[model samples]
Target chain A: MKTKALLFASAFVAVAASLPAMAQQTATSPTLDAIKARGFLQCGANGNVAGFGLPNAQGVWAGLDVDVCRAVAAAIFGDATKVRYTALTAQQRFTALQSGEVDLLVRNTTWTLSRDTSLGLEFTGVNFYDGQGFMVKKSLNVKSAKELNGATICVQPGTTTELNLADYFRANNIRFTPVVIEREEENVAAYLAGRCDAYTTDISGLASVRASRTPVPADHVILPEVISKEPLGPSVRHGDARWGDIVRWVHYAMLEAEESGITSANVDSLMTSTNPNTQRVLGVTGGMGAMLGLDNKWAYNIIKQVGNYAESFERNITPLGIERGVNNLWTKGGLMYSPPIR
Target chain B: MANANAAAMDAAGGIGESKLMAWVRANLFSSWANTALTLVVFYVVAKAVFFFGSWGIFNAVWIGTSAECRAAKGVGACWALFPEKWRFILFATYPFDEQWRPALSSAIFIGLYFFSAMRANWNLRLPIAWIAGLGTISVLMWGGVLGLSFVPQERWGGLVLTLILSTFGLALAFPLAILLALGRRSHMPVIKSMCVVYIELIRGVPLISLLFMASVMFPLFLPEGVSIDKLLRAQIAIIMFAGAYLAEVVRGGLQALPKGQYEAADALGLSYWQATMMIVLPQALRLVIPPMVNTFIGLFKDTSLVLIIGLLDILNAAKVAVADPQWRGFGPEAYFGVSLIYFVFCFAMSKYSQRIEVELNRNKHR
Candidate 1:
């Protein structure tokens, strides 16, 4: 029995050791090439998150993260519909990307240093800037997070949300008990049942829960303070720089289009714009797409098919009642900025 | 009534006592301790029945939108969720207009089971029927040949996918399981050790790990520009996992057979394969029917684990159904419906196993 156990352990270690080496075998854009050969992009997505990634009742995939994949698909195939979605749980998302099962993972995964550097993944660009916040009943009469000194909070375990809750409370020198639950639904139930005084998670999640989970949406108010930086984005395996570049540029193209007053409806007229930047981005005056080994009209395809960043955002996120706060373009005093297409 | 009572009393002299009172006296009020315990249990059960009855049936909203569901929240079950999302829960992302294909396919599966269940159909005809039934189901599901629109395997989900995974997994695993069981007991050391290693290695790991390897790792092992269908990979994993566990159950039955049976076959000068096929296997298989069916029921429910790998089985479909922002917070209604479906399938398997156990054990009972 002991020998058998040893054999299992060693076999596991050997497989684990060989996987990283295998993942590094290809240096060129093999993933992009394979996706082209396959005729459709395989997108790893979140199955249930409302504004980030989800399929509607008719099984149509829609959301901000979903749009990111569509944008990439549009850039490559010139057809945004040529993408197949694979719903991935949070735990399986990174490994699914690393193992080459998915061409791109736009699954509301937070961009963190450890995940980006150590996990052999590259975060292309932030699609949604999320931050941890708290939600409390309006009946509590608490105006701010600092007022809840002795309250018990319900949070999902093993998440940055729980860590942020602890850190934020300790930094304020306040005392609060935590009700750690494993699933989101249970945490929402505990909060609604008055088992805890507050529920803490990402601001978008708090908004989602308040809008949907609560019996009365107006009764729960999300706290004003955000405790952590969660820049959710699209990612690809690290070694495929060309594929990574394509994804990064696709996201940037959306932002740049939004910045350039380009909407999907107006993109055709803008194709004849006299401004050099607009001309270059619209593929009327530059060979930028050739540099990426794609058609000169790659950005044009993305903007035409998947829309600009704001269009995608308003269509997907605004329905969840999330405001375009820090996610707005830099010209509008937000962090969304794009490098020059020229 | 009075005349009849008088006539009965005249015909047979009897004490004036009610049958209900007599039963209560014998059962509930047999002794001091019994009467007290029965009253307590009855009170608790009655209260529970009242609570669930009001919550689930009486006050429940049968048909309405999410607004009505929200209005009845906490006070009653939102049964309206089923009316709204039943199609999504059962057929999942299969094209809405083309849902009748899956519906028909599921009916055919149940029909095939019904046909195969009869004792009279236990022959070559059974296998032939299964082949035809499954072929028709496949044609219906993936229909480009029959003037029906083509629905790819990726769009398949919900109860149909669950039935597909469990039924096909078990059907394919059963023969492989028997082979492994026989190989484990074979005199050839190489074959025996190989079978032992295969079973042990597979049985040692959790099904989730095997599924993870299939979903994530298998693609990496394939050469560049080549990929297998995710559903097929998960199906293979389930088959391998069920095969290992089923092999051990079969081995239990094989070991239980007496040495005298083998000796008797040997004295008859029959070859090993012939004796094993004609004499040993039938009895051994009969002895293991209960445990074998127990494993089948387990594997059937374990198909839900495919949800973790992103395949939408019925349970996952229910979850996705409730995940719609408009219908969020109605998980209990969706899950209750899902549980009923699972219970029906698993319960049928258990009852069928009991029936076969009794049928096969008739001679022993005599």
Candidate 2:
């Protein structure tokens, strides 16, 4: 046994000698180059959360998050068809992004300080600004989150919601028992099956869950308490700030398109417009895309292919019954102001 | 004396082939085509082994993530992530000062496993010894007294947590399974039906569903103000699930018992319980000891599924550790390392089972 242990240790040491050289492999960002060569973007998404990211009965992936991946694929390649989706759990998301197993995370992940700074990730932009809320059965007669004191709550574990729930309860000095599951959809089912008294997550998620209810959502009520700020967004690794900036601005261009009234329907007409801002955005003006090694009509192609931010939201979120509340344009008394194109 | 006759049959001034070469010639190189195929098989296997050894041993990273790993360089492995997160990967979310409890518990569990596996120690007092030992380990691990602070099972994780789940699961299931298997073959219809219902119901459902039921529906069945930790609930679900399968294994041994043994015991005027306990069960249990060890290896691997219920066993712990921003892209190495640990355990037990099987057959022949 001693002889074997010595042999094993020596073998370990011999293997350990090469690790230092491997560790110095030079921090190069090869993701963009890989995507360019493959002519497609490999995007990771939530597998089966309705309206956020879900696979259809036919096994094709489809959702608002899935659409964001399509939009990125369209922006990179000329066609939105050049996209591959990798399904991921909440616990698996950051690791997937960090490992370069997926080019970017388009899952409905809540942007938080710990995840942003500590996880070596940067939130590109807020695609959906949401808030933590709860949904309970109507028979419970629970009208608000405050009334949920002493109630048993079903929650998805290993997420931003877990921390937010802890913080909310600790702050309010209200105690509630938690029944945790790793998968969100399972927790939703368990909640409805009377195993748990309430289900807690982001407000948009509640609406999506309600919309897909088998017996209709009227049996349940979403309480009016917005417990914590949830900025749902896409994130890329921090290895390449240049690539991060490009992804961030892709989202920024969509918000700017809505602000400047550049609808997908009239994007062609606006491309030929005389307005300095439109000219600058559409290629007749400043060389914005040229700075990033892309063409000046890059933003135009994005808008033409996928529409603006508000359009994406209105087409996806509005139909799921998520009102504009804080997601509306700045002129409509909301907070979606963007940096000017000029 | 037969040399002349053998030389005559050889016909070509030789007895066809030497003894050593004759065996190989017949078995491996019977024809020209067979010789070619054998050489090809040997060459391919050697080449495959050489390639794997070069990739896994020669070029792999063993420690420290450098700029190369950040850029994803090594052709073999990126083990710098394990170096950066060695602690968290070994003990998830556990407080720094109290990690010794889990470490100590793991040592105790390993020692117990070794002791219990020896046939010499397989006595009536061993179960009692196991209960006392495990009880002490749990208290020491979750100490709220004796100047050691309390740590909840939810906070307990990593390799030790996996060990605990498998150990406790076996402790709970094995004896219960034996009794159940016996009851299933009982003369009384009521007890037989009860055992059959239990085994069938548990065997029918998926383990994941049972885990879900434990995590969610279990608390509802209790009166108000009663609560159970999520970890304990998952443990109970695993034990019950294993018990049903183990009951079938024990029943196979019972069925293998000869009818003559039952008749001889009955002819001695012994009661049914006495016949079973004193005469049948011992020989039957000894017959099935080999398969029972295989069940243990299966249980050891199945413990990983507990991660779905939110307990941070080895797989989940390694996941949480690699997800640490400091050790970016460390999934391949950490996952591979943990998988090696699992392979070593299950492989060793399976091999031991094979050895004991041969020994048991040898003894039976004697």
Candidate 3:
């Protein structure tokens, strides 16, 4: 009886000891394994933000952030359509990612020190290099943000825009009243109703709001000055190093594809090119894709299915009247530079 | 001869008078004060009506881009965008080709509801029919067999999701509520306190907090590798919240019951379960039908709150539809469309409840 009791206790201990190990393995890349098992990527996005991650009348998701999701899907499954989008609001985005409701959050989220260090999240890379700008009625005849002294501006509360507006005004010794609104649509309505002299937000946001909310797009003009930097990027939950690497590399691949002049239309032909840089990017040589635990054709699939970064920007953002600005490649005097794939 | 002539005139006036004229006199011009008020009100209402009619229908752009809508902006409403974007509003991110499944499933659900609303259909077969109907909807929606393409639950949205959440939330909550009601009234102290605590705790908090907790905090508490579906978590929160309120409603019916009913069941030597089921519950439940239906209607509207947790119910889907760059300024049209849909469903449910109440009262009298 004593021996039997001891054996039972020992067996229980053994099982208990192994349980956490089993759990650790599953928890390490829980999102990645789940995506593979489900045969699709679950991406959190801003379904209402035009030129970032909005859906069209046909229910097709468009915009730059949406393209990131598609590109990641292509890299993983070799099919861009193998993605499901969860339309999340600003308040719900991080919690949705933390709870594993989505494999990735590719919304127009700004990367910051606090979010990177404390939120248990890792931002993959900045997809849109944005800055805060002002929009005023053309009747105001304000060509620059500096001219808006003593102006009442409409801004969304609890955003970097509010802080930037305050900083810019204080630094320039301009007195201004702020009509803080919570919703984007409400801000636009307040601005149009003359509640404020100007509407302040990220430049891309101002362009989108003006295009969509104004009866005549020409009635509103975005100011010439950009006050603060807002580098919007995709983010993933921490503790998944391999998944982080995969998301980061997918972004780099798009920029690299654009720099190498490899359009989706000509990616197949470029796969046969002898040039070492194009060959490395097209996965004709090098094991970079394999290092990320993907097939050699992963980068090729992303370029062929979702196009390069330049194509995505032009397709989604260009129509909003937003210029490439600093989002263009380094070769074109922009900040977009990717390390060699080799 | 004068009296006869006067009587004949009165008779002629009464017989030949227009019904419209009489109605106007009786309803609109009954008193001098009423007549003045009515005329003033009529003028104001008419002005508003004509303004809306001209803006919304007569001069509105019917089908065009934002530019066309803008050109006609000062003259009329920009209604052209609705026809172009109605599909996205109705179906949300649901795939275009597979939309028929959600559409057909929604129709089936409504048909089942109408069928159950008939007083004659209230029997054991009702539950059976409901189960069969729900099963069919599930098969159609989450298809992996019968040669249909598999659409995951994450892809479900818009009106279909709204109906599913409310209907499923109410159906699941109903039985749990009854159990809670009985437990609250139970002689066992432990069971009674547990029931009381659960009901009161859930009732004390708002549904949104519960939903937020379920979507965010609940996952953190679970062991690793165990994940719940986002829609399911929100649905569960709705059910729990509804169940608590429903329990109190059922308890109201239970308290109103005469003690003689229970005493009579005891005198007949029936078991506790048997006595409650056969003798007491039927009368109590019949009495509570009106309040029960009121609760159901509230639950139906409360389903829209799921939008906060990112489930695209009909309201959220409509918001998303007009959020496009091309249709940004057409929020009024989108909101009006969604409000109409919500009104039709809630109004039908209320009307059905009135009919059921009348029918139940008639049966009680009989």
Candidate 4:
């Protein structure tokens, strides 16, 4: 009886020993399978920040980040309605992606080297070029980031914004007090309440915050200096290179569509034309989509379902009164550039 | 015929039957003062129920994705926001696919808690089971070894963090507290003074400052190259906070044990450890059970403070969900959802403690 029991015990131990290994093997990037099964992309974006991502009073998500979500949905399902948006804070964003809580993240998140190698994420593409800058009330008359040496700055916790602020101040040999708040709304309130002398975040965010103000937009001025190179873009988990390619090209196609003037309003007429660039981009004369495991004319569906890059921006970001400035196209000598469609 | 019936009832002394006025006289209208107080109580209760019903039920937005909750800005609750963003608020960045981790873990946690709360299992065997079960849970959640790809602690968040912090915190605190309590009562001057110093200082300060010290200062205490995980620091702070409170409660129990019980142990020729473990402790622990459970509830709510440390819990998760540009202007729904989750947990704990109190009282006679 004791010998029989020993045999059973050994067998049980062997099975239990391999369970974690089996779990890891099975857990390899379930996100792609899930998205294919659901036929819609689950996206993570910031909940609020005017020019980047924000929901309207009607509960419709808008802004550059929201557009990225829409563009992915349009690419996959040929309709933007298939998207499900999950909101995340800066600290929560990477974890969410690693956990597969979201298929892709386009919440104006900066792509950094440490995040690329250490965080287990693949950067799809940079959609917005932004940099960290400080914003102070015009009443302070602080002309530059270097001038405000001893001012108390309100910063959102759990963001590189805080660390960069610390670095800048130390480098400049300036001493400043920090009043940390988690939510942007709280930071805005505290700043308005005169709890801090300044606020620091992305320059575009400063413009967004300034526009979101109530009574009037007369109170704040964004400093002329830009700090860190914040190439904010979309990201996905590090697996399934096929899925990553699809997301990356969707971004490139948006910029390409804008340069080609193939917008939602004109996509049908353009699709009918024999123009080589349009035919190549719309996949009518080439096999671009098949390379990414998608159908031909995927680019056409994307632009048709969701507007071109410029159309999305004007409808969403332009209302925030942030001129394209550096976000303008390459033909106009700005940074918006996409490689040839062919 | 009526007159005859009235006469018969009067003769019977209202034993089997009574009129409306008679019932009023017997229960509430017995005296003028009693009737007046009864009217006031009825009025207050009716008004409260009426108002709450109108706001919570009659005008509630319980469907259609929170867009229909136009009254979200009103004084009463706007439940529509909760319905719309319930998943984001509850799960945060947890992969929608593996959300079952927190979900299943939540169920396993609650089930084990209920199992321990069972009267039959409230003993040494049960606490041992609890430790084993929680250890398994932690291993399952934070997989790094056994070929499982590790999920970093930085990504650990939402209700998962809250559960781990409170569960481990309570487990760690109870033992340290017991020792501290014993030390506080010891004859040795050095140990007694050390326990006193530890207890007084921790109890004197707010829990927030202690949390800050853990996250910000623990790194400073460690060697320059050795940086501790921020999540572990929060856990340590929780343990320290819970220990101070638990120690005081234990000290009260120790003080309450009758002198004769101590004398009897001494007469039995048992060593100090044996006597305390076998006899004195059993009685003292029974007396402190109810208060300790109350402390457990408090700690559970207090775990929400991890939000300040940048780890998302129920409260913080709700705020983030509402901040989603898609949900816009639905902060109230998020608040209502999170509040309900907290209420369910704290409410169940209180009820369990009450049940335990009653059972313990009944068994004490034996």
Candidate number achieving the greatest lDDT relative to the actual structure: 1
Please provide, for model 2 over B1-366, each residue's C-alpha lDDT reduced to its tens digit, 9 standing for 90 to 100.
599887787775454467657888898899999999999999999999887677667766666554556443436667666666666656665566777777788888887878887888889767876887788787877899888887655457777889888988987899889989999999899999999999999999988889867754454344322346667888999999999989999999999999999999999999988998899988888789778988898888898987665566888777655433334345667898899989988887888788777776786788
Clashing pairs in 2: A23-B66, A23-B67, A24-B68, A25-B68, A26-B67, A26-B68
Model 3 regions lying over 4 Å from their true place: A1-34, B1-40, B363-366
lDDT of 4 by residue, A211-327 (tens): 654235676888888888899899986644556777888999999999988999988888788889899999888887766556677898889987888888897777665778788
lDDT of 3 at A135: 92
lDDT at residue A59 of model 4 (Cα atoms): 35
The better-scoring model by DockQ among 1 and 2 is: 1
Residue B11 of model 1 has an lDDT of: 58
> Which one wins by TM-score: 1 or 2?
1
Better of 3 and 4 by DockQ: 3
Candidate 3 at residue B171, lDDT? Answer: 89
Scored by DockQ, the top model is 3
Tens digit per residue, CA lDDT, model 1, A1-342: 443343344335534544664455332366677888889999999987888777777767789999998988888889998888888887778766765678899999899899887676789989899999989999999999999999999999998788888899889999999999998989999999999999999999888788777878899999898889999999987655677888999999999999999999999998878999999998888788877767889999999998999999999988877889999999998999999998
* CAPRI category for model 4: incorrect
Among incorrect, acceptable, medium and high, the docking class of model 2 is: incorrect
lDDT of 3 by residue, B231-284 (tens): 999999999999999999999999999999999999999999999899888889
lDDT, candidate 3, A22-109, per-residue tens: 4553323445667899898989998888888887877788989999999999998999999988888788887677656788998899
Model 4, range B130-181, lDDT digits (tens) per residue? 8777776776666666764554454455676677788889989999999999
Q: Give the best candidate by TM-score.
A: 3
Q: What ranking of all candidate models by lDDT puts the best one first?
A: 1, 3, 4, 2
Q: Per-prediction DockQ scores?
A: 0.32, 0.02, 0.40, 0.05
lDDT of 2 by residue, A1-342 (tens): 443343334334534543453355332234556678767787878754555665432234556677678777666664665776655555556655654556789898888888887666788888778999999999999887888789999998888789899899989889999999986546866887799889998898787666553245688888988998988889986645556766777787888889889988999988779889888877678988766545677788788888888887776667566788888888888878778776
Q: DockQ ranking from best to worst?
A: 3, 1, 4, 2
